[model samples]
Target: MNREPNAQLIAVMDEAQVSNKGLAKRLRDAAEQRGMNLGTSHVGVQRWRDGAGIKPETAALMAEVLSTKLNRRITPSDLGFFSQLTPATPPAPPSVGYPSTVSDALSALNGLAEEPPKGPDAGRLIVPDAELSSAVLSWMISRPDGVQADQPASQRVGMRDVHAIRAAAETFMQLDFKFGGGHGHKALRYYFRYEVLPLLNATFSEQVGTALFGAASEISQLLAWSAYDSGNHRLAHQYLTSTLRLSQVTDDRMFGARILSNLSHQANYLGNHAQAINLARAAIEGAKGKATPRAMSMYSAMEARALSNIGDHKGAGRAMNEAERYFERAESSSDPEWLSYFDSAELMGEFCHCFRDLKQRRESVQYAQRAVDDTDPRYVRTLGFCRMVLAQSQLLNGEVEAAVATAGLAVEGGESLQSSRFQRYVTDFQAEVSAYASNPAAAAFNEQVRDALARLDDE
Candidate 1:
């Protein structure tokens, strides 16, 4: 029967010499600056005064605004009993139910990519521990046992053992990309704990030990990225932390930068844009002259993506320009295999996405067209992303028919890709189509997308 504290809110209003309406206006202004539209009416203020508590996220925002306005840190707890109010909402059902395999979890995530945001309720989704344990066990069961050497004990262990470890790591990477992280992560972790760790612990020459360190670091990174792709952020962060330590053991600066880039991508997707930008910047700085040109370009591209999300259009464009220059320079030579996957077309496609997010329709359309024309058929996911941007641009330009057509193509292209991230881009585009739910053309397109996604889910 404890009442909510109205004292803190009242004190802040009195100190600022502002009425509730004035405070609401200021709060709205601050939220708008950060790309949120918060409409707090005078009635809402009165409700707070009457002991009705705000949602946790809204309360956090209020704390942020008060801290900025008062030039001091202000936590929700300062508001008294309201801070103690737990979320009334129940937790969301797990994406995959009990007894799910790694493959099942991945498929479920891919299916979820098509679901529209269920509002604040979406945050309730929890990944269960049983799902994680099952995935790891499946991966471990799938790996072949280590082969014993036939050669004499002296020269038997030189280059052959290293080659075998590297081959296993490469296979795991392919599995991760094709099947998603959940399927391969357990096996990768098993390899690290049983094989890689033992090899590192054994005495060897400096060169052999360095080679072993590199192999371990690569496996660690694959495991971390897989955990991330599977929506296990906390586990992913833990894996990445270990990967960083392994990379340091080998002085593998480039690999460390790559891991940081992936971390930045996770941060951006989680809506922590400021942290994303900072992590990306740290990655770029860490690479310096040690990383290859292609690596630098990739890092720059990551930074641009983070900046765009944070509403820094000018900085994003500048970073994109630099990324293009590096990509051009690398494309001229026989690019390394690792860097070969990212080309001018791919970078331009990503640039189109950045422009679309910033609402520069003309720029988005231009780059999307270029990307569409140049993309390879094997990269259907990239094509889908580019087409989605084009559809967005078309929608903004009032070309409803054209937007629907473009979105149709995007959906078709997305159906072929295994990437949940790519599927999400198309789903978001479909949601925009839903904005025109009354328009016959848009409604038709929306229905088509819904049907397509439903089929995908069934599969």
Candidate 2:
């Protein structure tokens, strides 16, 4: 079919300062980075520039490549290809690609804030395996660029501003723990995008700049966690990758390692157990002497969780033992404030998960009780999850009445939060209790859970 030349595509390529061959190479690498293989070359890029139609997925990838390269949001429509998409072709998912630099990361963050990706996994670039692995490896060996903010933007900043950002992050974090991600996700994004992101470009002393980037990393990780809890895995991963980029600029190895552990946790949740284990191990390796005992313990616990999920019981147990040992050595004073949430209650919760997955009913019950009993009242979501695990363990041991009572409590507690993860936990528990549907207690517990979930959906 004859078509008009894509003048818009040519203009953007020129604006991005990339030749046709360079754009082709970048598109190829972008696909490869995400565990996808694309055979496009300069010829194809030229064809697109000449108004040849492109596939929806390729169009999305091309937009992402130009977006990061130019450090701004770019869509296929910006390249004059909107009408080329036929009715049978689904609209391409938006681009949330891995960023190549700190500036690119900031731009990507702004894009996410202005328009959060819709649906379950719409804008994800990195899959659990190759792309994720590549991102983690790049973060590990990366060196910091010294004396950041030497060339500042128009605004001036100081340590006071940095502290304010940190304070706001702490407040948002507490809200997330108490009321779930849905309560604070939008507000947190607005705060970070408007209140904090601009500071990254402002003039400050090296000391203040380091503190500012560190604070930004913390908030970014919190954003990732909030997104994960809200069932927006694509947004979560993008936030985390951006967090890693920010942490690198601060030259804070331990903080970056913590971010890696967060990625590992999410990877496990998304069913990429092997990748999760690798990421946890990468965190440990990268942190080395930089991580305090508590941080080390948390990474090991993440590894144990993944191992258990993959049926590597012996490996999981060894990792769990190591986690406990390192945790025993932890000093409260030496631990970073960002890691304060991983106390004994949290460790016991990890143990409960590992044991539960391993089908050790007795051990799971013991740890689950400790996790639930020791959790602070402020940690409502954590408490509900611990109770759910305890209930599941009790059912496994044939304590039907006790299990039903505990599950009912879990359902009641879960009603107060807006976390999809918590709802999933409740659903999983209900599925387990289905075999005992003939039992009156189990039947009532299932009904209670269904009602609770229905209420959540309405809200």
Candidate 3:
């Protein structure tokens, strides 16, 4: 029978007289010393015992912490199976659950790391297709016709039409969230080009035109976002360029900031971490005092997320702190309807993800728990992501059993949501769990997650 180094872990635990809570407290304290705020809870430590290993870099940190506590050099091999682990394959569509939505699609695009393709591999991009460019131009030319030309130039277009388009775009956004971008983007693109653009072209007062442009710009950005989500990065990039042009024409600073945020997201997805950070900072600086509190908060959160990806832990934490403050400020300040998504919970969730990437396991778990606790039921996708982060944090802490349990919950929640990003999280967690294949519980969990992922392939 193959045995792990559990004996060493137990010896250290006993010598240190460390209860699970004690170990968690030590981990939290160590993290705090490194400028990470984390919570100490028994559940957090239980995850470590369950064989949920940390990221390799984080495992190194944990080794350092253990060495200090035990007064001996601790290697990841002493933690059992963690040092040898590798990242896992991404889950398939069927396992992801639910219909693809624009957000789900975008998440899929963002999750691609240029790593080896997994599952069916049909959706992965290998080479840019010229056909997508032609499709975009064709869609752009099919704008809706209007009788506005027959009317006096001043009376040609009306606010009611702008409102109607806004309403339609909002509906499409919702649909895109539920059904993948592939299902809703074409219709929205068609609507914007045909109906909305023609209206913009018709004669209208400066004030009315500005409002119309804002609505049109937002719809265009959403179209771009949807395209990005659907794995059509080239098309998405083209749409974003168009949206930026529209924002510039309108001189809408807020819209410009929003487009910049999308660009930051794209940069991050493409592994251009430095470019992503620069773009996010540009968005924040450009908005300056002009952005509503909610918008500013959202921008700061984006900055923190990008910083985390680039291994700027201190900067990322500071950005998260600033974002939290902005979120608090927004509570007393009424915000634009479009900016309502900015909230403390959302920011914390984003921060947790950053911590996960940085391998700050204790901090990741703390923030993830807070996010899960504070999130609304309707934000199932966010909640699922939070759970996945928590599970990963747990795994990193050396709690195989707890990691498996937490990962199971994450997988179940993600599978129910039909989010490719969430499924990728599950895949990563499975990869982490594979470190302890020698553990019966860990092996069982791995098999279960694998099976779940395989089912996704069928869909």
**In model 2, which residue pairs have backbone atoms overlapping below 3 Å?**
none
List model 3 lDDT by residue over 1-459, tens digit each. Answer: 332334445655675677977777776776676555557577755555554545543444555566566543344544543423211221221221211232332233233311213322212222222332232232233332222233345446668877887888778766655544555766776676567766654787666777777787677778777666655555565566456545554455666777778767776654456666866787788778777777888888888888886667789889988887877777535565566555677877888878876777789889888988898656656677777777777776877788788777766655544444455456555544544555688777767777776775666
Please list the Cα RMSD from the true structure of every candidate, rounded to 1 decimal place.
11.9, 15.2, 13.3
Ranking by TM-score: 2, 3, 1
Top TM-score model: 2
Which stretches in model 3 have alpha-carbon errors above 4 Å? 1-155, 178-183, 331-333, 416-419, 440-459
Better of 2 and 3 by TM-score: 2
Backbone clash total for model 1 is: 0
Q: Candidate 3 lDDT (Cα, whole model)?
A: 0.61
**Winner on TM-score (1 vs 2):** 2
- TM, every model: 0.63, 0.77, 0.64
Residues 107-177 of candidate 1 have per-residue lDDT tens digits of 33223233312322211123344543343233223332122224233332355677778889778766654
Q: Give me the overall lDDT of model 2.
A: 0.80
Question: Where is model 2 more than 4 Å wrong at Cα?
Answer: 1-98, 122-128, 150-152, 457-459
